[model samples]
Target chain A: MNPIPMEQSLMVAAMLFSLGLIGLLVRRNVIFMLISIEIMLNAAGLAFVVAGSHWQAADGQVMFLFIITMAAAEVAIGLALVLRLQSDLPTLDVDAMDQLKGGDDA
Target chain B: MFWLTSIVAIVATLLAISRLNATHALLYLIVSFLSVAVLFLQLGAPFVAAIEVIVYAGAIMVLFVFVIMLLNLGPHAVEGERQLLPPHAWIGPGLLAAVLLLELLMPLSNNQFIPTTGTAKHADHSTIPTIPTEAAPQLQERMVVGPKEVGIKLFSTYLLAVELAGFLLLAGLVGAFHIGREEPRTSAKPGAMEVPSQEGPA
Candidate 1:
């Protein structure tokens, strides 16, 4: 059996990335947006591993490890922010938090 | 075979991103991650595949579910979410996917997509004095990465990176702790009445 071509794996990564980008743009809920970001990050990690395996080098895997670590840290901060927002705001909707847009005195 | 698994993962992700309910979206994302893990295995990175499953699908997904539960977005919120998913939601993603698909397909169209030549080394070594049945087994072994290689390379070449990652994790822990802590009630209200600390709410 022929080894799967590197192009094929890269194509899958692109598709995943695109889907994630769309999700990030379309999802209004802050939590859903975070999930989209995670998807995009994972897709990037997949690309690294695929490239590394294609070239027979361990560097891709090392980068992937770093990506995972980065992702974990990101999610921790993101979710913490979400929790804080939920507590301080009346609603979790992104539009509702537009108070930062310079308000007219109430 | 790889195509099949990847397609499944992509479709699951599509379903996930389109869903209005946050929990439902997360579940589909988990499905997407699992299939991607399989794709990683097929691509000859078993260690990364395991991490994909354990960290991405298991631990991370569980954390998302926990947050969803804690937020308690009820049925009314679900209704609002549905309204938020307008028809235009598909437009942005579709356009982006189209552009990316074109870029990815270009290499294949030009016949520039070369299979990794490194496989030749493994093939050469495995072909010597191996029985026909044993050939498949040896090839399979060549495809997988051992944890030992990953560990040695990680500690030796990427040692400083590993240290930085640990430091990053510590920072995340501290940040999460600080952000998630409850705020103390202010005691400076002039006209407000204060109840005893042991007393329950009236």
Candidate 2:
């Protein structure tokens, strides 16, 4: 069995990051963008795990743990804001939301 | 050997993002995350992979799917013509990919990265106890500390952080309730006339 080197894992992570970025950039729906953000966060966590494993360092795994915690907090707040925004504005499109002057709070 | 599974995972993730359906995107996302978790296992870190699947893919994705269902996000109703990727949109991603590829893979001068010609993995295959070997980083002194170790670590070393996370979750619950459980927007009564559009400001 061929051992997967750190480099290969990193490359796969890079691809995931790119896919998420593209989705976030191109998608109009706010929910989709939020989902993409989660993907990016997951990729970052995976990278840390990869590096940590290669180095035999638990620090990377510990860091990945923190990242997950942060991600959970972020998504919760973000989705709430999006829900509020949808209430005020019928659509999730950023362009339409721009019309609401006070929507920046969301 | 495990790299093949990792490749499959990456492809699944890409497919998920490319698909138009949100549910399908999420299903593929789970597949991708699972494969990455397996890769974690192969890297001698089963603990991390377990956490990966349990926390990120399992708990978080359930919330994500629930929100999608709540939103009732569906295919575009108009859905006639589709536009190609904008030329300008490709610049940032393309450049980033090129730089990352060059930097991460450039050191493979000896091609030792493949590990195809060596006993590197074969040694760990037959003799290595999958769980114990993979968790070598955590189990140092033949301690049979199952989930209790995690509990101890979380309570002792990460207590404050855990409390903070709890508070954050509390806030989120409040916020979700605030956002999703709002009063109706329509001010007028059901039978009440929507005052005929007055063209100009008086």
- Residue pair clashes in candidate 2: none
User: Which ranges in model 2 have alpha carbons more than 4 Å from their true place?
Assistant: A1-3, A101-106, B73-167, B181-202
Q: Model 1, range B1-202, lDDT digits (tens) per residue?
A: 5776787779879988888777667767877887787677667666777788899988888788777666664445566566545566555445434443453355335432212122223433422223345244535544545344677789999999999999999999999988766546523221111221212121
Candidate 1 collision pairs: none
> Which ranges in model 1 have alpha carbons more than 4 Å from their true place?
A100-106, B73-142, B186-202
Best by TM-score: 1
Candidate 2 global TM-score:
0.64
TM-score of 1: 0.73
Query: What number of clashing residue pairs does each candidate have, in the order they appear?
Result: 0, 0
True interface contacts retained by model 2: 0.31
Q: Report how far off residue B177 is in candidate 1 (Å).
A: 0.6
For each candidate, the alpha-carbon lDDT, in order, equals 0.70, 0.61
Best by lDDT: 1
TM-score each candidate. 0.73, 0.64
DockQ, candidate no. 2? 0.27
